[model samples]
Target: MAYERLYILVEGDDDKRFFEKILTPLFEGKYDQVKVWKYAQQKKEKVSQFLKSIKGMNADYIYVSDIDQEPCVTARKQYIQSKFKEIDKDRIIVVIREIESWYLAVLDDKSSKRLGIRYSNTTDNVTKEQFNDLIPRK
Candidate 1:
């Protein structure tokens, strides 16, 4: 099935760069089937505002900020559902703890195993700075 578009709403530049670098390559052939666009906030974007922006854009999938602010899982989930009321719950994937997870996902298998983590995934309560050290800057 061809995916119309996948819109990922990130909080900042780091999240945008990290995801595109890691996830984009993995979905190489998918480019023909799906298009991923990154939407970043100019300021502190509230969930309500972010959702509204995405809704206006008519995205097929919405990956929104789920982590950060150290919010608990329940709070994050609830906020996501409530804020993005117009979005399809199935297509709306809340990326809980994005920074650390996106970074870990792209790490070599040996590195991920040594770190006890995987790309596109992360351990609970991991900090971005801690994960940042593991990923070399280009």
Candidate 2:
């Protein structure tokens, strides 16, 4: 039997929570179902391996990783596309930038400024802590 759910794989629990706290609401009841699989930072785990394992799950994936690798975004995207040629490129979003960027951008001005972040409807240097505080109840 099919899951009949829109599955999304994220890099970590934080990414999963972050997306749920924000984006999930936007998609509520908009589809048949919704789910998120968060990856753990295991010593032996490779991102490629993670991709391979989830490829057959027939779910959309969003890879939110730090741009610590060379030619980071392009490389990750190419690897995923080449490895899983059947998956839609748009369904696979490899964020070469840090996930903190997304979390910070969602905060209110007061919180952003308190974290020494300039939210001129633009950039920020806020960390995960600041993000958690913004969504304390969640």
Clashes of each: 3, 0
Per-residue error for 46 in candidate 2, Å, reads: 10
lDDT of 1 by residue, 1-138 (tens): 543445555656676676677666665565443334455544335545655665675534556565566457556756666755654556555566656655555567787678765544435545677676665566
Tens digits of per-residue lDDT for model 2 on 1-138? 555445566767778887787777766566456766665454324545656555766544555444445376667777656754554566667654557667666668898678665565743444556555555362
TM-score, model 1 to reference: 0.53
Q: Which window of ten consecutive residues has the lowest lDDT sum in model 1?
A: 30-39
Candidate 1 residue runs with Cα over 4 Å from true position? 1-3, 31-59, 69-74, 105-123, 132-138
Q: TM-score winner among the candidates?
A: 2
My TM-score estimates for the predictions, one after another, are 0.53, 0.58
Q: Candidate 2 lDDT (Cα, whole model)?
A: 0.61
Quote the positional error of residue 108 for candidate 1 in Å: 7.3
